[model samples]
Target: MRADRLVSLVLLLRRRGRLSATTLARELEVSTRTVLRDIEALSAAGVPVYAERGRHGGFELLPGFRTELTGLNHDEALALLVAGSRRGAQVFGLGSALASAMLKVVDALPESYRDTAAGAVERLLIDPETDLLSRRLDAEDLPDTIVGEVRRAVFAGHKLRIHYEAVGQAPKWRTVDPIGLVTVREQGYLLAARSGADRTYRLSRILAAEELAEPAQRPDRVDLGRAWQERSVQFRTGGDPVTVVVRVNPNRREELVGTAVALLAEEADADGWLRLTVTFQDSRHAEWALWQLSTNAEALSPQGLRAGLRDRATAIASRYATP
Candidate 1:
């Protein structure tokens, strides 16, 4: 770990030219004293690192001094390249930074492996805007300023005031104690609380945000996964849940079940259909999910949902009937 820190110190200086011990400590998640010690170790290894004194002074690598110290193997290099291709970093406002870092990694790679690895990565594709079904999966656009403030608040443990537009609701301003920021399926969410009650805000839905001077009222360290899971469970069960029994084509079973909040039971029939007891947040949710499967799935029970679908189909048929 010490060795890794030393190499990282050299790279940080090489890239940024100069950075104070305090800044380095913050970036490396260490201490100013630890950073000073690492600098000593790097210089002892003849790395041509020097320190400048004074308030604005910091550590820097000698002009034109570059190190071939990335030490990333072929598989690792490929993995980084693939990750760059996904453009996931763009969501966090790090697209340009990720690109620059990838270029540096490539330049630091061994010459013989570099060309082969670069060529191999060209054959791989990830997160294309349109999938095989021609369905577009583009991510929602978020203002850099809003994401920046929200991110700063979460990391700095500060409260944030946000102007948010919840679904079917008017825009309103609220102050929240941010717990964490999470991105799932390219959608960003800010998990926070208002007045100590758990609340989750979609980052894209936030029109504006400002980090507050007051520190957030939250745990010093949060188990984000557990918190998110607890919130997810609450959300899944908080609403009026509707359960339905459906017979789905075996081939489309996953398509049907994937949209359900939970699967209570399942059984396969000799006729090649699967019977599933599925729960959804409500009647509208249940109807919408099964409607996506068209005729492949039949809602067996809960005549209300069946009637809703029938009415919807009739409305569509009337639009084209003998027209």
Candidate 2:
């Protein structure tokens, strides 16, 4: 609610005097424009919030002004309580801060709700490292120092200088206006723009990062979900996409679809096998997917792929024959 957010905005300024709109937005998880509007709303409501103008200028509350408003309700506190103890967003480098905030919330909670909230959080699990199969989920080992720097830049709305190592390429320096940060399946990505063109960088691939003081070139209000979706579409359609048809054991169907960009079709065969048409990033990706299935899968078309697989098998057989 705007009212709850306004109270938070004021409280933030009270605690950390003279915070920039960008910083407040980062803390409140809103857009800087929204933060600016909230500041205006506070001023209109006769709050002693004043704005200073200059390089280090920001909004600050008048000394001695106090409010007894508790911005959070039972549900709000519990929601934040749950998220504060989770491991999901820790990849963005706010772990300690989250823990501290959770502590404060717990302390401020009504005595009746404190124990209940704690009990509720204890029953829930999030972002576990291992799955039901006992297989460990892949998590990028990101350095805290680098991620902290990048996180600061993204929230501060500043240009970022990164020493990046893209796949199959040497390390290079690149400056970008960071739009947002995203983590998927335990991997982190920075959504940014370079020279007005959208670009995405893997956090694990960043060799180094420096937050620039210069303001970023970006719209004030951002919809990260929409931006990410558009980028994902471009990536899926722009690659050297290859469609391949293959027959696989029904039990291993998931293994095949998991690596594919798109599953075009699927049907069962008379022999109890499954025929699937899937799209991969490229011929190499298709070839690799089929090879992983070993004898359980066969390419139904694209004779080049069949010949390639057969040649590979022949070499393997020859290596073992009478050796």
Candidate 3:
């Protein structure tokens, strides 16, 4: 606990620049007395930690005292730099600060490790291209303070209160137990358990978030990784499965069935035409499938889907008809 407190204290000082004993105790979840003792230990270790006693006074790192990172080989140093550079703009906030801290760490390393570190850097080149910039998430627009708090709560198994906006409604406040953070196409989403149900919330929809006083309760058994996978939009649920059959010419059978109709089961006839059967949840899905296989395949079963397709075709043809 002391070591943890020391580490946290150091990070807090580095991040906030200063903190009162009360604030440090609250953040570290320890007593003020404990904070004082830890400060003493840090000072003893040549950390140059100092405290001020006044209305506006608190603990601060002495000016010109730097915490250097030592013990890294060249490869490790290079790897760290490369990883930091690859993080892009998000790092500008947290990543840049961390990279700066790492530089201090690298400076403390012995001369013997410099070559190893240099070798590691030479072994790999990191090029975070400008074109890929669009792929990075825009964390700048998000609340800087709460984003990190929400992340901590999620990882620490705590609950959160969020003001969220759905597609067609004004933003409303909701309480959810944090589960996981999902990154999709460079957007950050929070997979949370709603207060009264087993549903997840998206972080992008969250207008604001704060941690709750009560600790989070874990499920009897949790498979967070599996739950994340099952929540993907591609996972199907609750639909009447209808089978559709299609006929394709032999010459284009391989191209059509292999690429376009591979999801369906196919059978080839002696005349070089292929008959294919596929099951879909709804008429719309079937229609979409037909559109993709247009001209290459013809519907052979489920008269309803065929009729709908025909109706759509008529409507499309009528649109271009001469007056």
Mind giving the per-residue lDDT tens digits that candidate 1 earns over 1-323?
78777777887887788999999999899999999989888888898988899989999888998768857778879998998887567776667788998998899889987998899899999878888999877696888888888888988999999999999999999999999987777888899999999999998899999999999999988999999989888887667899999999998998988888899999998898999999998898899999999999999989999999999999999999985
> What is the alpha-carbon lDDT of model 2 when measured against the actual structure?
0.89
TM-score of predicted model 2?
Answer: 0.71
- Model 2 over residues 1-323: C-alpha lDDT tens digits? 89888988887888889998888889999999998888888888999999899999988999999988964676877798877766656778777888888889999988888888888888878767898989897877788999999999999999999999999999999999999999888888999999999999999999999999999999998999999999987776676888899999988899999888899999999999999999988777788889999999999878888988999899989999994
TM-score of 3: 0.51
- Stretches of model 1 off by over 4 angstroms after superposition: 1-69
lDDT of each: 0.89, 0.89, 0.69
Task: List residue ranges in candidate 2 displaced over 4 A.
Answer: 1-68, 71-74, 249-258, 265-268, 272-274, 292-296, 311-323
lDDT of 2 at 243: 86
Judged by TM-score, which candidate is best? 1
For each candidate in turn, the TM-score is 0.75, 0.71, 0.51
Q: Which residue runs of candidate 3 sit more than 4 Å off their true CA positions?
A: 1-146, 168-170, 219-223, 233-235, 238-243, 246-276, 279-282, 285-323
Indicate the residue-level lDDT of 53 in model 3: 85
| Local error of candidate 1 at residue 165 (angstroms) | 1.0
**Cα RMSD to native, each candidate?**
8.6, 8.0, 13.2
